[model samples]
Target: MSFRSFLLIPLVVFLLKCAGSAEGRQSGIFLPTELHPDYPGCPAVDSSLYYYPVIGILTHPGDGASGRLSNATGVSYIAASYVKFAEAGGARVIPLIYNEPEETLLKKLELVNGVIFTGGWSKTGSYYETVQKIFKKALEKNDAGNHFPLYGITLGFELLAMIVSEDKNILEKFGSSTKASSLQFIDKANIEGSVFQSFPPDLLKKLTADCLVSQNHKYGLSPEKLQNNEKLAKFFEILTTSIDEEDQVYVSTARARDYPVTAFQWHPQKSAYEWASSSKIPHTEDAVRVTQLVANFLASEARKSTTRPDAQEVRDNLIYNYIPTYGGKAGKGYDQVYIFT
Candidate 1:
């Protein structure tokens, strides 16, 4: 064949192949059935499931140490482990400064699909009021047909109990600080509609049989007290309990009955992320899996939210804008912390 004819023949074949591929796509032969918007008899795409979910993490007043990490006035901080946990579950984080003005704080709430009340000591004063306000907002969002989730960790759990009980003294002292404990599953029925439902059976068994969780709080609600408090009992279903150093039983895991709110008296984030020489935080594979599973659970819950916030506003408020300091070297329990002034 002539050289020019041969080149033209190759070009014609390439064009025919491209046309066939396009026809194949239009005929559903090349398109994934689940992803095609107009595929007949296929399940409709769930627009409600947002993949790029944003979580608001409430910051504590100070670093775990008093004026040790930062001495600036009106200072607040978020442990980097919590941020890492959210990311592990396929979510981004935004810091909800507890001390920010009411108007600003409420605005930030609108941007987040979920919120995490970090484990902290201040469950009173403005911080307490702020947490209560945010908790109510989350409930309101759920009540209004929007699926919003909230996670209360350690001290956050205590705050939730106190807020729901409407009693500041609801929490009793527990010698659980810096301790590793095995979760004692309460009842099989309790896990039926809860977050733990998504957990693997083997991991759930390990959670009950091994010390795969870390507890580091001075106060927690006893199972007996949680049972007697009408409001608390009505609001949350106790999932698991753990014994403290003194062998006192305290509520370790619980979830709201009607809302997408969950509370943990143990530090799930510390198991894989935080490294402190003096801490009892487990770093085993199962322990790290606990963190991963919990993170994924919360992120999945957040994805159910229908809030499609402005991308620019979310970008401005994301935790990525902040830098974390190596607090672990400073003798603090946290490996890294984002200190805000």
Candidate 2:
């Protein structure tokens, strides 16, 4: 071949490969970064089907007398709603028992792509040293370029805030409304590129009209508290706020800085999975859609991990060695007392 013809052949091949990659991205197969600027640094989605993610729901100390019926000391449980939430988001769920040995917990963490610190009544108390360690380890993994996602709801949210702020006193007794209410989208520009980036316009719009968020805690982070605090202001960008019945404004949701960590002061799962007297949870069509949005988003993020827990690990941790129980209530498609010994 002539010299110019030989060189042209190599250039054509390289350009063709580049065109194929661009076509893949243009077809909605994307890296997390392309989907949203806040996404973790992870492998791009290929044309292959997405992985079915698994979630570890951390069980914790209970707060009330309702668990008096169970033989366990403190109810280490997850709402059936959360299980349904995971399933709806195209993932499977498992219980992460607290106090497990660090190695065992670490093994399980390696198996799942995400972990959820469910809400409970530990506002003024402490998390199991194991739970704390697991959380810290997950943070380290994400910081080290592993795309692991952690979600905290209600008390879970408070706990994360406490951890990131390194201030035990960051959470305070709300003293205002704890009833179910919708949220006000504050500083829309802030959430524009975060986890909610893909929100349907109608779904995002309903945040103002629908009573979708179920609030049940007396302890929460207010906007003032978030702004004035050094650690919190630096660690999270507040995405939404709500005016309680007593006109008190609180920080309802936040996304972490430089990580795929998200938290909510309101119970997004309650509207679909919880129902107790005085719970006052929302159950409207809008409420269900909002719940599903969160479920799908988190699950989708969970799918970003390039690995899955081993089958033996799944059997040992989620199925064979454990017994599931219900809380005596009906949630989406499961019992209230779900996934506890």
Candidate 3:
């Protein structure tokens, strides 16, 4: 063979090897069935009998008035974000559809370790009712000695509060308010109260004197409403009032108002501050800190799962090692990625 031909042959072989290595690293390259042929079935991880946690995320139905399907985009992004983070900490994440039948959902829930409610549009009466039933069932199961950890973000956060508090008032109070397009009422409240007017100490602490959160959602439990509703009061009493000093539940503008279930009004998945500092968008450092706190909180929750192994821990473990990517960026060793424009 000519010298040039021999050189080209070796170079082609090297290029092929590199391409194959790259393809192997990209998770999307594999089919779901190939990744886990027993999917929808309980499949053990690798050669070991051990299995990673699976997380079920509820998608937010988009604007019902607009006849839009639930905007799984944002929810999916956040879910993927948690999954990435959880995988990093040693776990797995599985996304579940909200429209699936309750029976199917429950079955899937059993196959996994936890559940997450993603944020989107306000849900209708039927959605709330269905959620209530699901919670009741879960509680019954827990009482029977089955434990599952749950997490909510934005809308999901509200759902978690409703579940623990069993207060239907959250629906009547903040539910409709989240449907508003702007912060007009919140702005008015700020002006009336000088932004530092003392709120309930517990509520104030959860909010942390951060006025920026007002920009995210206009509605929250008014002192008057909390004082008037016996059910709501009882719910809050259970979630926030009765906490032991040593309990580690982290309350934030994002997470729970109180309790093991948590929420985040802001999109931690967006990494808003990081994107903003890089001139990706206008952002505040506080936003970044909030997101990091969220990540840290999830990590903490995952660690707790080593002993508890509830649904939340199972979900957290799956997502602990997850890395964010975009497009087919999973090709770069990321389990998931955000598609932010």
TM for every model, in the order presented, reads: 0.86, 0.78, 0.48
Per-residue error at 268 for model 1, in Å?
A: 1.0
**Who is ahead in TM-score, 1 or 3?**
1
Candidate 2 wrong stretches, greater than 4 Å: 1-50, 62-65, 73-75, 123-128, 175-178, 277-279, 319-323, 329-335, 339-341
Computed on alpha carbons, the lDDT of every model, listed in order, comes to: 0.89, 0.72, 0.42
**Models sorted by lDDT, best on top:** 1, 2, 3
**TM-score, cand. 1:** 0.86
Model 3 TM: 0.48
lDDT digits (tens) for residues 192-213 of candidate 3: 2121233334433433343223
Best-to-worst TM-score order: 1, 2, 3
Can you tell me which runs of candidate 1 are displaced by over 4 Å? 1-45
| Number of colliding residue pairs in model 1 | 0
- 1 or 3, which is superior by lDDT? 1
Residue 199, candidate 2: alpha-carbon lDDT: 72
Error of 3 at 24 (Å): 45
Encode model 1's per-residue lDDT on 1-341: one tens digit a residue: 89999889978997677657855446444545546667787667788699899999999998756677888888999989999999999999999999999999999999999999998789779999999999999999999999999999998899999999999999899998887989999896678767688788999999888999988889998999999999999999899999998889999999999999999999889888888534688889999998998999999999999999999999999998999988787555788889989
Summarize candidate 2's per-residue lDDT along 93-160 as a digit string, tens digits: 76776655567667777778788888776544335355567779888888787788888888788888
**What's the residue-level lDDT of 175 in candidate 2?**
50
Error of 1 at 85 (Å): 0.7
